[model samples]
Target: MKNLFFSREKIVQTFETLQGLIDGIRADGKIKNEEVIALKSWVKAHNYLEMRRPFNDIINIVKTAVSDHVLSEDEILDIKYVCKKFLDTYGGSKMGHLHGFASGIASDGELNEVEWKSLAKWIHTYDYLRGSWPYDEINALVHKHRSTLDLSSEEKEIIIYYFNDFCGLNKNSSLTHPLNEPNKPITGICAVCPDIEVYERTFCLTGESKKYSRDEITDKIFECGGIYKNDMSNLIDYLVVCSEGSPMWIYSCYGRKVEKAIAMRKAGHPIQIIHEFDLLDALEDAA
Candidate 1:
């Protein structure tokens, strides 16, 4: 009985590893020579003979993408469909699968865009809101086997934060500009000019940006010599509105921030509420 149970557990583990392998391959759209070597090498090293058929299927699919060295929309959709199909039959440990995939991609030094898409999809699919959050699970796993995994403190931190951002937890660290800042940009004194240089400009962002995350926008702001603040105050020089005129954005989002900025402006503060594109232009001009 003990042997039978252990055997079943091992099989499940194998499936999880397989899922991770597929994910790592799908990440970054095109499989790199290094990734192909890493995947095939890892499987062979582990002696996953039973998984050879399905593994080869995935490898073939990836190879189709590799010929062009770019993943098209159709190719991306096909890969996602194939991965889902495989998961349906051999669903094992979601956390194990994610870790496996993440580790495989990171093995090559940096996780790419395709890889992030794969991880984010799986993380959302297994969100703790339903079962276990991938971020928490990975962190726990690292803590349990930190030394065994040979994880550097920095590597562990990166993995944890990646999962957090992927899962939309947005947990702020020193790496991110904090949403809450004490120095509100004073308004009335500042000029509201479209031609204003981004350097030393104070910006308060509101509404959902379609193409940029808050962090990305903040990073751009810093790069352009601008300051990003989450709230509105007399000190804010510009309010970058990403989603204006949309009912959801106007009614359900940033209502308070918008109101406060308006009130400050009415009170003779010089805060100008501009569109996200305008902010981008300002950044480009400064660049």
Candidate 2:
């Protein structure tokens, strides 16, 4: 029984990774050689899970598809089908299901009125997911569009961009189809142009920064009269996530600190997960 439990836990974790990889690969709408290598590497890394049902089937499909070092459109579709099947059968957790559902809704590269209504209903049904990193944010965005009789092209673009980021899709994805304007704020970021109060708020940093070193960031926080902690805690008012090299996970970025911050936020902690650029802007304003 203990071994069975352990195996199940491992399977869930691995399955989540597999799902992320698939989303990232398909994000651009075309699989590249590097992506094929990544898929092959993922299969090889998680070979132990092959003894299971969907994993076994998934592994076989990936192996066969990549064996020729070329991923035809049809082959990619087959892999996505299997992954979707696995998601339907064993959709690990509510969060996982939310991610999968959002991906499915945006699969056609557009979110129609029907799909938006369906997604809104799903979000409403999962009231327990409220206050969570994405659930609350997504809920707000959905209702915002639903109330409007007609959405502008930019508004529609916002919906697509938000989901693409949430689903771990590359910003450069064909689906994003960047508009000729200033960069849109990342929807996943808790605060867009936040009024940063550094005087007394506690801050925590996660991921690497391209502009500043760890010590420099901590120094800046101190200089701005903010407290900097290396770890996340309830005391943390602002969790400044470095934009550089931060990989997007299903709910948050790829870090335990991020996961903890999201969990804490869901539990009623007023923790704001801001981007490094936000911090820089705050520092500049203070100066």
Report how far residue 197 has shifted in candidate 2, in Å: 18
lDDT of 2 by residue, 51-76 (tens): 76547888888789889998787887
lDDT of 2 at 259: 66
Write down the worst ten-residue block by lDDT for model 1.
183-192
Q: How does candidate 1 fare on TM-score?
A: 0.34
**Candidate 1 all-Cα RMSD:** 18.7
Compared with the true structure, all predictions reach lDDT values of 0.54, 0.64
Indicate the residue-level lDDT of 67 in model 2: 95
Candidate 1's error at 202, in angstroms?
46
Clashes of each: 10, 0
